[model samples]
Target: MIDETPVLDDHLHLDPDHHRGIDAVRDFARLGGTHLLVVNKPSWHLGVEAESGEDFREVFERTIDIVDEASSELEGRAWPVLGVHPGLVSRLVDDRDFAPEEARDLMQAGIDVAAEYVAAGEALALKSGRPHYEVDDAVWDASNAVMRRAFEHGADLECAVQLHAEASEDMTAVATWAEEAGMPAHKVVKHYASGRLEGPTPSVMCDKERLETAVERGELFLMETDYIDDPDRPGAVLGPKTVPRRVRWLLENGHDEAVRNAHVETPKRVYGIDTEATLDRTE
Candidate 1:
């Protein structure tokens, strides 16, 4: 309906355990979305504490299943974005009573597993970031070290790292970490970003006001809903249809070029894949 510009959500999650997995992808396609990066939720969210690096394979494999099913079912295309969520550090420290160093080691091992997925070409990118909440100096330092490990993996794999952090947090300073790890700052995507971000690519949350501002500034960014498909917390961060719906708004308001920039150009640049190519491979 919107001239086939290929709306792609930069961040999304699936809940297969609740029978809402493929259904959520269908919702996105119905609203004109053509693709998404199906990021794996944290390991503990899957009811496992992740005792070892291989433990994360369960999380990545589930996400890969969602991606394969979404593509096979013709519910648009999906790519896996797999990594350890940085929040694991806080949980390991406070809940599991692990030292900050131990928590960091576990998280780095998780990242190693995720990188193996990327190396095998099962995933398109990595997900990583420090805790968005308050943390002490030790926990904070450990998280950054873990995040840098993720960046190093991204550098070797030549894929983007979809970072989860507050806009008020490390948006600007993260460039140095990426550089030290040999990943370009542009290859680091700032998830939940709004407006013009300084270093990494902004995976802008689907907000018309912020979108309009970014478009006016001619910033290169991606659109996402951060959709977490929970029946109880339905539409908490946003619904699956949010990205495509906002894209339609952009088209109707005459921001056609911006739509293409966010959904196609930036994705291709970051992930080295796009709609038609992904479709052809699936077909």
Candidate 2:
């Protein structure tokens, strides 16, 4: 074991087709990871050849099964993070068969399903945001509307919302929308954030410099690998061990308390996860 403060990867994708299932979780835990927030990989990202909402739903359900199985294998060490990914929203809008209004409605429906799952205690957070890069104004507006709907539903259910957007995007605007939708700012987490960002919502960063800077600034944030687990791109973005490794880096550099806050305390506060309980179970 890592023999230090417990580590948590706040965001990770763990579909059966790509990820190694229980083996991956075992490896992560061995490396000192206490918990992880497992997100569903959208059909588009997995090259699933999906063309309609039904096709997407099939992929979404499969992903949920993967997450559920992982959680069972890990014995409560993993929590679910489910929602319509913004890229999937863009793809639906771009499909010629779907009218703009229909696409928006479909996206909102996906969020509704995720919210229901969260309310049923099957999930801990909702993942929604705009495209990684800029998009047409109309497409952007529709995606934002879908995200707002997720925020509103998450607020009602008291679940956190994890934002997957471009690092350069205006985080303040996201926080504003969350507030207007009645979700508190602290409940919105900007996924894949960097040092350049500053706003109401806390963020999770992967870049070493950005992670260190945010920690120095005393920013409320978490760490993630965003591990796709794709065999073709093995360890793409970062590996599953990235967060635990980073925790070790921080400890070696004399940032032990920062590591505890980011990997233990912050996640507990935001996602209602109990790292100590997870550790106790694993032990």
Candidate 3:
């Protein structure tokens, strides 16, 4: 493991659908001696696709509640970053078994309901033993619209987004939308896999180079690690120890130290605490 302490472990997923409660999270962070940015995604399962009477509103409401709980409990220890996965959006918009017109209409209607639900303290979607929709087009538009409204609420929260684009062109398009919306395109991390069930390599497409580019372009970029591995795909999975190793590599390779320093620094600024300082004490 890299002996140096990290200011922040920039990306983490704490979906209740996958895991339960904050205790596991608290124990994980304490044992590792690292602070995390707990990320949450709307749960959309493949099995729920053909089901009738399924609604997306509950997903958003439930997700928000989990976030609220995590934020309240973790407080300065962890920050909650909310985002809609691109794959989910694509699934929502795609014309599946549901009638195109009805799917679209219901999707729009769900958004209105979600807004009200959010106002009513239903921002979380942690209904135990319940299933969710798979990724699609209606989910895409709805998630985008949901994020836009989230910004309007000025909740003083900054969440990370992960995009699962297939190609450079698709990635660029996603980047464009993030840029236009004033969302952190750089901070919006991408997960690499052959499809969605694989893992990524360290040298996959535009990994470190992309971070360098995002930094140069004044966008936010943070290394992230997710589950599963894909030989054809690449993940910035440097891990806790590997993070400082890469930092040393960047510094030795003639990259600007000031720029490298900003990777963790900026996240600290947005998350409202000096994780770097905490890391310093550990060192």
- The numbered model that scores best in lDDT is 1
Rank by lDDT (best first): 1, 2, 3
Q: Quote the positional error of residue 6 for candidate 3 in Å.
A: 3.4
For model 3, the stretches where C-alpha displacement exceeds 4 angstroms are: 1-5, 15-33, 45-76, 89-96, 100-162, 167-173, 178-220, 228-263, 268-274, 277-283
RMSD in order of candidates: 2.0, 2.5, 8.7
Q: Candidate 2 residues 37-127, lDDT tens each?
A: 8888875766764544455556566766777676654433677788888887667766656665677777787787777778888778888
The whole-model C-alpha lDDT of candidate 1 against the native structure comes to 0.84
Error of 1 at 74 (Å): 3.9
lDDT of 3 by residue, 192-273 (tens): 3121111111112224655455435443344444421222233434333333344445555665543334345555443334
Query: Which residue pairs collide in model 2, if any?
Result: none
Query: Model 3, residue 185: displacement in angstroms?
Result: 5.2
Order of quality (TM-score): 1, 2, 3
**TM-score for each model:** 0.95, 0.89, 0.48
TM-score of 2: 0.89
